[model samples]
Target: MPDAVVSGTVYDGYGREAGGGLVLEGGVLARVLPRGYSGEADVSGAFIVPGLVDVHCHGGGGASFPDDVDPRSIRKAIGAHRASGTTALLASLVSMADPLPAIRALVPFCESGELAGIHMEGPYVSPHKAGAQNPAAIRGADPEELAAWLEEGKGFVKTMTIAPEADHAMEAVRILLAHGAKPSWGHTAASGETAAQALEATSRCAAELGFEGVPQTVTHLFNAMPPIDHREPGPVREFLAAARKGRAIVETIGDGVHLAPALVEDIHEWAGANAAFVTDAMAAAGMPEGRYALGGLDVDVREGAARLAGRETIAGGCSRLSDQLALFARRGALPFGQIVRACVAVPARAASIERAKGVTLDFEPGKRPNFVVFDRGFSPVCVVRE
Candidate 1:
């Protein structure tokens, strides 16, 4: 006998949707029934998608991850994103002089299963493209510091963002792979050739280590990097090309503020499942427009966009992954199925959270039930996890 059943329009975490009913048993999806099958809960027209996975997010709910080390503040941030339907998340910390303390602070959450892992977005990036990062903290790649941070993470450091053009950056990439952590290329001014070289190095290293199917990502593509020019043709061109070929998964802040709807649509058309949508969200997400902190910098939020105080450089996002889904749906940029894959499956695969034991986000038999029910407007009506 089933513990419970939910009948609705169901979307497999990949790119398929059907009208059916899901049977829950022993805290897992025991069966998926065809349409017209009656159930204990009938959602009729609502849309059911796998719970969202955010690979890059600083904080939310009025708490900043990089600035707060308390477990309570961390839980507050996790609770905020979780309320918006993000079941799997990586607590991203910005560049700092020494990140071991912060990495230590986040490892408990990873052990307790409250967080998927930790993402360190660099002290090893190009100063020329630092974006909102504090300039004083930026430095050349240091393999020693990288190893210390990863060791202190206790195997919970899943990703680190590095600039391909930074000194000894390739060495740093090799170190991350050896430590079972993936490298994300961003905050860079690297030329197209340099970007291609880094991608090849990561691929070769991953293959040598037998780490097949593990994703190498471009952190929030086109945000801090140089724009593509016909003659110059910087890293953006190479990153997009890699994404189109499935060689890399590119993270796009699809909040409508970071990327125009048309550009987002174009990227999706080119990259398809390889374009992963991420929030890169900060403390202001789910909160009223006001002051917030993203690392060492103070930010002011107004009109739904967060920016550094007294500057125009856009800070991290103030929208959740669900809000990005709604924005893309409203723009009619891509099919709802594709958008769901970008927000759910792609990021999960990139972060390897989909492979975590007892945590598959699909509605497949024997997999734990982790999903969100959204109305026609794409607002989350119900979120379920087991």
Candidate 2:
């Protein structure tokens, strides 16, 4: 393969994903090599973060990717996400009564790489934390039905958000894990202790990625369940306290709203680069803030934030991973390197695809960065690259 090198300041350090002079022999990174090598391309002041992953997304741009949405519309939505540098994405699908028809219909396309994976965001959540998901679309989790998704969706199903405290949720979690789908607890009124129990239960169901087995996740951080009371410390708070037995774990949405900049800083200090930054984006992302539909529910976007119409609950974010990184960088909330690592390494770990990621390199303090060429600084630069 011919070598093509792109060089800049290496910001990300996970999955061996470096950002300086990434030596691409074909599309795979050959190495994070010396500067001014024969095939190197230089980009000064640029930072490299992962091509973002959107695990929770509905529509972006002016289109929706749901099965009911048109083919052309889906393409448009995906294109919008691509513009923002999202290389991996999960279709955070909303429910339509029973979701099987749409899942089956979209399977061929998704299997054929129309989407990275599917995240069933609703139809099994608390009505209170349902947010913008259609209550009409909500259903009680049937272990049998979840098993069908595990059977049919297969590798294309990355995650399924369920109300852990709800009926049959643990059974569904077991079935989902049996079929290689990761289970994330969400949209429940689970108390703090219950949340910890739920996490332990899911851990029992899924094989712990780390040596120590633990459910190892809490979706949307401060979003569903209860608020952190000094005495009670709700599900979100308890999940935030996940650290034990050398286990590398903890998840958070870095939309700034999901966890404030200060909270993000706190997480980085505690978890290092292991903390995840998910968009949890909805149809309003990459598009103007206004009215839209998320999972068959009415949503309104005001000031670029989507919320359930006529309610205080947030539906999802209206931004991309790039936007989150930009915000994090601008705020200087955490060390730039750590921020980049969270964006790159954590998401890749979540998807279990660290091997195929960008460039990889190890460095000593004296050495300059190994691989660093991404449009972390300029929008126009990214546009030009394509």
lDDT of 1 at 9: 76
Compared with the true structure, what per-residue lDDT tens digits does model 2 show for residues 285-332? 887778887766678889767888888778778878778777877787
- Residues 1-386 of candidate 1 have per-residue lDDT tens digits of 23666766788778587557677776678887786665567444367777788999999999988998899999999889888788888999998987777888899889988898999998889899998888889998888888888889988888889999989998898898888888899999999999998998888888888785754899998899999999999999899888888789899999888888789889889988899999999999899999999888999999889999999889999999999998888778699999989888888888777765324456778867777778888898777765
- Candidate 1: worst 10 consecutive residues by lDDT? 353-362
* Deviating ranges (above 4 Å) for candidate 2: 1-4, 11-19, 25-31, 35-45, 207-216, 243-250, 355-380, 383-386
- Model 2 TM-score, all chains together: 0.84
